[model samples]
Target: MGLIFLGIGIAGTILPVLPGGPFYLVAAFCFTKSSERLDNWFKGTKVYDKYVEGFRQKRGMTRKEKIRINLIADFFIVLSLFIVDILFVQIIMVVLGLYKHYYFIKKIKTIKPGEIE
Candidate 1:
């Protein structure tokens, strides 16, 4: 199960059609619960440094990174509007964006890139 998530995540990172970080983070978490060796191996990867470690350490993305992520999400949401025309669905997407921005602002600690806590 963990490996499946990790594989999808690695593919997602390159594909751009799927959100990679969340899936990878989920995989890391599953590995944490299931296999210490796998978790440590994931920690050693560059992907872990780029996506998960900061949040895991309670130091979140820089504001610029937050903006970048939200913007990308917005872009995908808006694009989906073309294919999924249900008004309720559109509203849900917009709400998801709002919640994401709120999460970044209120929950995650803003950090400077490359600054270790």
Candidate 2:
């Protein structure tokens, strides 16, 4: 399971249609539950540096990255509204979408990946 999410997250880093950061986070979380070796291996990988390191360190992401992630999350939420038929589920998804943007904008501090300033 963890390996699967880990694979998707790695793929997501290259594929625009998939959101890499979230998938990596999920994979990391899942890995922690199973093998410390797996988690450490991932942390040592370039994918971790590219997608999860800053956020994991509480340093946040670049403004542009945040926007891209939020928009991708919103797109999936809206897509779910069509895929799911229950009004309550749809409403929950909408709320989650709005909360996604709100959390990124309000709760996080943004920083570029390699800016010295």
Candidate closest to the true structure, highest lDDT: 1
Taking all chains together, each candidate's TM-score versus the true structure is 0.69, 0.63
Instruction: List where candidate 1 sits over 4 angstroms from the true fold.
Output: 1-26, 44-46, 114-116
Which lDDT tens digits does candidate 1 get at residues 41-79? 988989888888866775577888888876777677678
TM-score of model 1 (CA atoms): 0.69
Look at candidate 2 and tell me the lDDT of residue 56: 83
Q: Which one wins on TM-score?
A: 1
The whole-model lDDT of each prediction reads 0.76, 0.75
lDDT of 1: 0.76
Q: Report the C-alpha lDDT of model 2 over 95-117, residue by residue, as the tens digit.
A: 76676677678877888767753
